[model samples]
Target: MPVDFTHPWVGRTVIYTAAHPNARPEQGIVTSVNVEARIVFVRYGAGTTSKATSVDERLQFLDGSDLILWK
Candidate 1:
């Protein structure tokens, strides 16, 4: 369930999911994919902490459902 770097994820728009299902989902664009560490970096806005991650539990892909939902 790690981030699927095999997909051309960079530059693609995505919805950043929160732990609470009802919480608002922040929208962002994929910036980088670290295949070595299985981390997918996303930029939500122009700020230092804007580069968020689309991962969870160290080995799970938090945006997998988002990818399918958006697709």
Candidate 2:
């Protein structure tokens, strides 16, 4: 499914779970969104660590899916 760039979830904090079984989860703030491209960029590890990072991820809206919005 395609992502909605204007969704309220954009610019919020979220946790991302990789589709791979062994991948570790990440927490970050949503930086940008591209509905047409189905991509979301997140800026993670801010204030929690000295080094912060941003990651580009594919949007997945399916229930019980890999990536999800963090409450």
Candidate 3:
């Protein structure tokens, strides 16, 4: 399913499920949304090792097939 870029998804919590088993389930808050690019930035996981860890990821809505939004 295509992502509704106009919808206010920012600040909402979401889960990302990948097709690969190695890709662990990611739970995070929607940090940013790029409507033009159809990509949502999510900040997930805790930085246990350092404060400068880059945990934020850019997720593309692939027909709404890989993302699950928490109501």
Candidate 4:
């Protein structure tokens, strides 16, 4: 499905990148994340019925990435 960019998906994403070198990432829910720069950390696919890829492996936990806020 196409991610609603104008909606509230930025902080409600299912993934988070590491700030430091040793920090880890959080791959929470896969149905609520956007593919932008500020809120998103990676863009490995597009469009509906996209090839299922794990967030844990699709995105890298490196420096200069954003964080994901969950409830």
Cα-based lDDT at residue 2, candidate 2: 51
| Candidate 4 deviant stretches above 4 angstroms | 1-15, 33-71
Per-model C-alpha RMSD: 6.9, 7.7, 9.1, 9.8
The sequence of per-residue lDDT tens digits that candidate 3 reaches over residues 16-53 is: 65667688766666665555444666667662321111
Per-candidate clashes come to 0, 0, 2, 0
Error of 1 at 29 (Å): 0.3
Ranking by lDDT: 1, 2, 3, 4
**Highest lDDT: which candidate?**
1
Model 1 Cα lDDT, one tens digit per residue, 1-71: 34454568777776665677587666766766666454567777564443646354222234455332122
Looking at model 2, residue 17 earns an lDDT score of 64
Q: Candidate 1 has which clashing residue pairs, if any? A: none
Model 2 lDDT, residue 49, Cα: 27
User: What would the per-residue lDDT of candidate 2 be over residues 1-71, giving only the tens digit for each residue?
Assistant: 45455766566666666679898766666655544444565666664322122233533332324443432
Candidate 3 global TM-score: 0.51
* CA-lDDT, candidates in order: 0.55, 0.51, 0.50, 0.39
For all predicted structures, in order, the TM-scores are 0.55, 0.47, 0.51, 0.24
- Candidate 3: worst-modelled 10 consecutive residues by lDDT: 47-56
A best-first ranking of the candidates according to their TM-score comes to: 1, 3, 2, 4
**TM-score-superior candidate, 2 or 4:** 2
